[model samples]
Target: MNLYQVAKTVVYGALSPIYRFDVHGTEDFPKEGGVLVCSNHIHALDPPVVGILAPRPVHFMAKEELFNAPILKTLIPKLNAFPVKRGMSDREAMRKAIQLLKDGNVVGLFPEGTRSKDGVLKEGLAGAGFFALRGDAVVIPTAIVGPYKPFKRLKVIYGKPMDMTPFREQRASADVVTAAIMAEIQKLLDAHK
Candidate 1:
């Protein structure tokens, strides 16, 4: 296993008991090729949870501020995370994400951009769809219920891979693509309810 895989395994092993972790639809994960794992951002733990629980090693685009901290600067990269400037399209970060996807790696993204304090799925940004289109990656919609209380079940539901080929062929706008992805995510969340 690579360092990132080892780290993910260890982290998942350690956190599994502390929080009642349950995963569904792991079989839906792509065994090979470029994949974009998109999900709603609930808690700060969402990224780590997705990264660890996923069948493949997933790289994330974390907020740039997180990388500025000395400890995280060193540790986050080891966990396969790159920095992205929020509220703006950070082209450099986007390029990195696209390259990772092109290399046939799974890339994790929170379409809501930031964690929702109220636990509601916010409107998604177009960035996820952009990467999925540019890299021709399969978009996997994911839903994370909660890690609210200790020993309480934190559910993660993975939906089927969303084929972006049609959307790309249609030359769909970012807003249209984002809406489609959000709709899929909403379905997963509704199922969880």
Candidate 2:
């Protein structure tokens, strides 16, 4: 197995019994091909929880600073994370994610572009839509509801895949597509939370 699979197995073994995350909608995840798993980021645990629970490996875009931190420098990459410069247009990182998706891999990121200061969901930036369009990947709008106390059964729901073809054909703006994706995520939060 690859590093991602092995690490996921080990992490799942350790975290499942402790966290016991209430994961939903695994079936919505496509069994193959390129996919963009966009979600609302709330906590530090958000990415790991979704990564471990996802049926497929998710290579997430992490803040560039994390890669230079003591142990995270070595460990984060093994978890299938790549450094992404935040608060600016980082062309290098964008190209990397687009290439990864084009090569038929799953790429996960937050539409808000950072953790929510409050637990409430916020407006999504255009980055997710940009990736969806450039990679020609299906977008999975996911939601994680949590204040994330230990032993709390937090919920993570993966909604249906959003095909970007309509947006592409219509030449829809990235902002419009991202708004729709965020709306879907909000709907999931409304239903489950």
Candidate 3:
């Protein structure tokens, strides 16, 4: 495990009860090899919950500004977290994610591109779809519910993996395809609610 991941695991474990994490559908995660994990963005807390409870380590994208603090700069990269520019496509970030997939590691994505304002799943951007198609990796759909009241139980559901082969050679309308993926995320969230 990466050093930052180790630290994150330790910290999250200590705080798990405070957050009341309750995870489900973990069995849906592949036992081995690389996979693309896409999930709904409900809150900033979502990534920690998913990363901590997941059967495998998941690398995710975070806004670049979050790493500006000196401590975070050192910690974030080690935790498998990378920076992405908010308003523009960060090609370098995408390459890093793809490289991780090539190295047989799970890369987590928030296809909606940003957190949901009202905790409802929104339309996803095309960035995630393009990565899945290019990497030809299994896409694991996921959803996170609740950061509700104080110490309320948070639910995280991992759906089945999606094969991108059929859409591989298709056109580059990543946004269009991402909408389909986001729909699955919404369904999972609804089921758990």
Candidate 4:
């Protein structure tokens, strides 16, 4: 296995026992092809945790600020993460994500744009929807609960793929698609609660 895959396996192995990590609906994850894995951002741990649990490798759009760190600058990219400027359209980042999707890579995104400091679900931004529409990717809604503290049970639930064909056919606006994604995420969260 490659270094990244080895690292992911090690991390997942190490964290699983300590955090009592649980994953559901992994069978629903697409084994191949471009797919958008959308999740509710509750903690910084969300991306790596979800990425490691996924059946395939996942590339995440992390805030550009994180890349400023010397270690992260080198490490993040190795982990298949790219910087994205928050509070802006960030067309370059979008293009990069789309290209990855077009190349049949699973891209992980938090539709909320930022983490929920209070652990409450926030309204999603249009980026996830945009990527989904642009790449013609299937959206997989994932919900992560807990791992807030050491030894706490952490659950990751993967919902079924959300087809974008209808939205595309109707020429649905970004806001409409985003709302639909967010609603599905909320449902996954509530189901796990």
Candidate 5:
């Protein structure tokens, strides 16, 4: 198996037994094309949860500081994670994400930029929006709801791609797309909760 498949298997093996994951809307995820998987950040497990539930492998953007650790620096890239410098514009990371999407790969990220610490949703950031536009990706609005307790159900829903046609015609800014993406996620959260 490929490294991504191997790691996914290991993570699934570890998490599946501990948490009962109730996933829905897998059909909403497109089988092909550049897809931007945008979601709300709730817990540290959010990324992996989305990654595992996704029908395809996901390329994740992690904070640059994570790459400072020796083992993580060695291991993270193999798992399809790239580092982004926080609190500043990191053009290199953006370019990488755009390239991945343009190549028809699925790039997943939490638009809130950090963990919420509490289960409450945080304000969205514009990076995900920019990535979607620049990569010409179909932005898939996804949501994960959890305070993550053992044996409690962890819910993940992948909503349909946000209709970017209007936005594209209007030449919408990344900030505008960010707002729409966040609102859709909120709806998914409310429905599932």
Candidate 6:
């Protein structure tokens, strides 16, 4: 395994039982191709949760504020977390995400933009749909059922890739695509309820 894989495994193992991580549809994760792994954000732990549960290495875009803290500043970027300015489209961050996908790495994205305080999937921002369409990458809609108890059981279900070819060709509205993707994620989230 590579260094990142080792780091991911160690972190996940150590945090396991605490997160009680339950993963489904990992087999649906592409083994050797670029993929856009999009999920609803319900907690701060979403990035690490997806990273640990995903079959392939996953990269995430985080808020620039998260890197303001000294400890996180040092750690997050190394863990493949890049920064996006809040309330603005951080082109550089978007570029990095596209690069990762182009390089055949899985990029983790939260369509909700931020954690859902009510544990409900929020309206998706354009980032997830934009990246998928722009990158021409496969869209993997993931739903996380619970962040439950901090150290309790949580279920993360990944659905099959949604083809964006039509969306691309038709020059579909980003809001429409975002809503559709969130609905799909909500369906998965509802299954666990």
How do the predictions measure up, each by TM-score?
Answer: 0.94, 0.93, 0.90, 0.93, 0.95, 0.90
Q: State model 3's lDDT.
A: 0.81
Tell how far residue 88 is off in model 1, in angstroms.
Answer: 2.8
> Which candidate wins on TM-score?
5
Which regions of candidate 5 deviate over 4 angstroms?
A: none
Is 2 or 3 the stronger prediction by lDDT? Answer: 2
In TM-score terms, candidate 4 sits at 0.93
Name the candidate, 4 or 5, with the larger TM-score value.
Answer: 5
lDDT of 3 at 157: 85
At residue 145, give the lDDT of candidate 3. Answer: 87
Q: Across residues 47-151, which tens digit of lDDT does each residue of candidate 3 receive?
A: 777787788888988889979987998778878899988898789988988888877888898888778889877888888888887765788899888864558
Residues 6-54 of candidate 6: C-alpha lDDT, one tens digit per residue = 7898988877867777788988778876899989888777888889889
Q: On a 0 to 1 TM-score scale, where does candidate 1 land against the true structure?
A: 0.94
Clash number for candidate 5: 0
Ten-residue region with minimum lDDT total, candidate 6: 144-153
- lDDT-better candidate, 1 vs 3: 1
lDDT of 2 at 185: 95
- Error at 89, model 4, angstroms: 2.3
How many pairs in model 6 have backbone atoms within 3 A of each other, for residues 3 or more apart or on separate chains, i.e. clashes? 1
Tens digit per residue, CA lDDT, model 1, 1-193: 7778788878988898888988999997889999999999988888889888899888998789999898988888888899989778689999999999989999999988888998888999878778878987899999998856888999999899999999999999877888899999999998997
For 40-159, candidate 2 gives per-residue lDDT tens digits of 999887888889989999999888999999999998888889988888999999999999999999999889977897878898998888898999799999999886877878899999
Cα error, candidate 6, residue 128 (Å):
1.4
Q: Model 5 scores what on Cα lDDT?
A: 0.88
